[model samples]
Target: MSVRTATESDLEAWVALRLLLWPDTSPDTHRAEAAAVLAAPEATAFLEKAEDGSMRAFAEAALRHDHVNGCETSPVAFLEGIFVRAEDRGRGHGARLLAAVRDWARGRGCAELASDAHLSNVGSRAFHAALGFDETEHVVFFRMPL
Candidate 1:
């Protein structure tokens, strides 16, 4: 029932949730990425812990100075990821975490906050909508080896 900044001690639980959200990434890669993210001054991660001292949910966000999809401002606050265990859904944890991140973004002088979900993830889209984010555009990305 408390929200706090994520720490290295929470890495295992954090990466477990990350794996659920992004199954394609290898555990080692996720560990490295999470470490880099946590070390960045422009990025922040938040964790919600239950009464028993275990993590309930987590959220990661960053200030994107580069062009961000659906953003009209430079240095927009972007929600990189969020997840609440299935058992914890519908308890307002998501909303509370998002509000804290939104405030963090504002404190950094960002004018807007942005996030996106996979096109086929209807539930995530609905969740974002319920949290007040608008559906701006649809895009499919592609990459080719050099």
Candidate 2:
């Protein structure tokens, strides 16, 4: 029941948790993307290790200077993803991981923390709201074959 900064050696377990978080993603793409993030200095990942020495939850944050949902030119701390295993919920691990990201973002000069969850994921929506996030708008997107 401890939270700590993620290390390169933790990549496999971290990626495994990510696969569980986004089950629709293929393993190959996950591997490549995880590797890239783990190698980036601007990105930070945090993991909650269980008493048994296994990763039970994790979160990732990155510095985003580009225009985001409602912001202008100022850089923002963008939460890439966050997940906690069903068996590990309600144990304060999620809060710890989030706190780490908040501190990291604050240290980087970010005035705000921004993140989004699928509209249908009630739990995520609730969690974000509990963390003081307000709904800005509903975003819909479309894609066309080129």
Candidate 3:
């Protein structure tokens, strides 16, 4: 498996995997987001690809300068999304992808990496814990139409 920062050549495949994480979003929307990620100095997408040129997993991340839960530094390396095909799970592809994201963040002088999973997603929570992330804080959001 080869892990590398995504390029325009990998855009379509990367977006396909990303949609698995955000199934409701249109391909156009993901395309725009992908463009921004590739353009931004603070954001990047890392892809793990099989020898056949198929991507097995990918991770998107951005440098969040704002205060993120459990981070004590500015420009926290925030994990925006990650997805591995279910068939590809438990083979260390996710960990390798995450390590790529971590190296990207560390290269930019970040002190910590931060991420969040939906409150009800036990599998996601467990995945994070297995990756050595500690439970930090949780909150339920409230919204009111103005």
Error of 3 at 63 (Å): 0.4
Question: The CA-based lDDT of model 2 is what?
Answer: 0.87
Where does candidate 2 stray beyond 4 Å? none
What TM value does model 2 have?
0.93
> What's the lDDT for all of these models?
0.92, 0.87, 0.91
Best by TM-score: 3
lDDT for each residue of candidate 1 in 24-90, tens digit (9 for 90 to 100): 9999988988898899999999989888887889899999999998889999999999999889999
Q: Which residue pairs clash in candidate 1? A: none
Best by lDDT: 1
Stronger candidate by lDDT (1 vs 3): 1
Give per-residue lDDT, candidate 3, residue 20: 88
lDDT of 3 by residue, 1-146 (tens): 87899999889998888788899999999999998999998899998988888888989999998889887899899999989988899999888989999999999999899999998999889889999889889978999999
TM-scores of the candidates in the order shown: 0.94, 0.93, 0.97
Residue 15 shift from truth in candidate 3, angstroms: 1.0
